[model samples]
Target: MGEVRVVAVDVGSVRTGSFAWAAVDVPAGGPGLCGYGSDPASAVASAAEALAAGRRAVLALEAPMSVPVPQEWEQLGKGRAGEGNRAWSASAGAGALGTGLVQGAWMLSELGRAVPGLTVTTQAGRWTGGDARLLLVEAFVSGAGKPVATVLGQHAADAEAAARAVADRLGGEAGTDVVCAPHRAFNLLAAQAMWAGLEIGADELETDVLVVRARPVST
Candidate 1:
């Protein structure tokens, strides 16, 4: 039988990153990190090119949100006592505290509008337990230093620290293995793209590029 390939995307307002892999004629192992990219157009283009090179492919994207919106904010609030409290207050002040999930859903809807055939999923939507930030923090810690934990406070520090952490994590065998095989490869690739942008001093608002590989699959 021909190979079955898969593609995953992590989309953002300005930049979008994707990853793809083939699982044909191979063991029941993880998916490969075929490629990544910045914009949806480029990411889709790259994936097509990869499909041209490989056997067959399927696409999986992170869902926008499955859980309640306020719950997600509460999740982000943990360990961020001050900012969390502030965000909570702002939400209360604006009477929009519980709309985070709705916002995420809306964003996902808008993104889907922009990219047809794109699917949306969230960390919770994937049934992947634990906070997304924690995963990011763990990745950063494994790759970089034991600097001050940014969850307490410090946006720039957190960004730098996370970037270094992601770089370090991706620098070794384990890191590569995770990105190549994990189900949530899109999140990892997105984290890497964010780290790269940080390294290049890209503005927070500026879109960044991520290169991904595409593989072919039987329909």
Candidate 2:
């Protein structure tokens, strides 16, 4: 049996999203979209299940980013506004949002720490939303070290090309042999919200949003 190669992803808020891949004997292909969800924990857990079903496998994840927030706001009820109360409220809201973002990042870090044998990485930019198939392809190609001709135009076509390139790099059956779990529904909505300019706050958001990889021990 050979090692299975797999790629796991954690979609970013403003950025494209995070992704990771590995090779295991279970399957030797570029990678497939195992599971998509808001939190990294669930995503990783699902990916791990996929890997176990196969054989030896490699794992990857997205790295977390840190954004700053005001300490006074984080404390609790601290500040009040006068004439510009609306502006103050907006500022406070932003700060609260920033704090949540920071917390999510921290949670992501913690998830990674708790899980062993997981490889983690981050994507730098925003990926325009569309069909999941296209995004999967784009992620594969991007991970395989192929040049993405143009991210702006022909987004779907470019992503497909990248997917093919990644398949070539993996040296396995391009699309057929590779098995992928469906993207989790919550993740789909979250990804859409992110694309729509929604800020993923910490306190209100779930922890699963940050998870990127997981591998379950064989029974």
Candidate 3:
């Protein structure tokens, strides 16, 4: 299989206008962070242009890309499965999700408008197919007890952390749906994009908001 570039964004408050991001050119390799910056729109536009020029990539957002609802619950008021105590509706997760809904949707819409026939998906097969496509995934940097250290500064470190996590995951199972959600699900971001005049081509059992975390370390 060919290499898929990974671009991870550590989203900040929309009001504060603070953001950070990291790009890993060869995720399967050392998965080294090749790029870092605070300009999200420029990074997104660049990725879109790269896709238009025939390059496969993954846009990992360090935010709640999808909201999970309990099967019998009347409303989405809890965290997703496997998220433990770090509820998506609480604290940082809640804020990020709110921002992600807008930022992710805007990015998707811009990509759709910039690329004539771009295919965005959560599936690895289609994303890494012969043609160029963008795969979207949620990145979980820290939660519960294991808080991510701000060694390289909070937002920047978060972006790098997300890139590293996703890269390592991809290294182990390149073809597996590591971060692609199972079952056909509805994503608010995708819906928002559709409302913004972007037609997103996604599979029935797929949504562009599967979560990716660092593989658990052996005790």
TM-score per prediction, in order, is 0.26, 0.27, 0.78
Instruction: Write candidate 1's Cα lDDT for 27-110 as tens digits.
Output: 144233344433345444543443455433233332211111223443432221112222323433222223322322333343
State the lDDT at 1 in candidate 3. 41
How well does candidate 2 score on lDDT at residue 93?
41
- Per-residue lDDT tens digits of candidate 3, residues 11-124? 886456468888887633466666777776776765765576566778888777666544555554655666767767788888888887777777777777777766566545
lDDT of 2 by residue, 151-208 (tens): 4333333223433333343353323211111211122223322433333322222212
lDDT of the structure predicted as candidate 2: 0.30
Taken over the whole model, the C-alpha lDDT of each candidate is 0.27, 0.30, 0.65
Candidate 3 has what TM-score? 0.78
TM-score: the better of candidates 2 and 3? 3
Q: Name the regions of candidate 1 deviating beyond 4 angstroms.
A: 15-30, 65-219
- Candidate 3 Cα outliers beyond 4 Å, as residue runs: 14-17, 129-132, 144-152, 174-185, 196-199, 202-208, 215-219
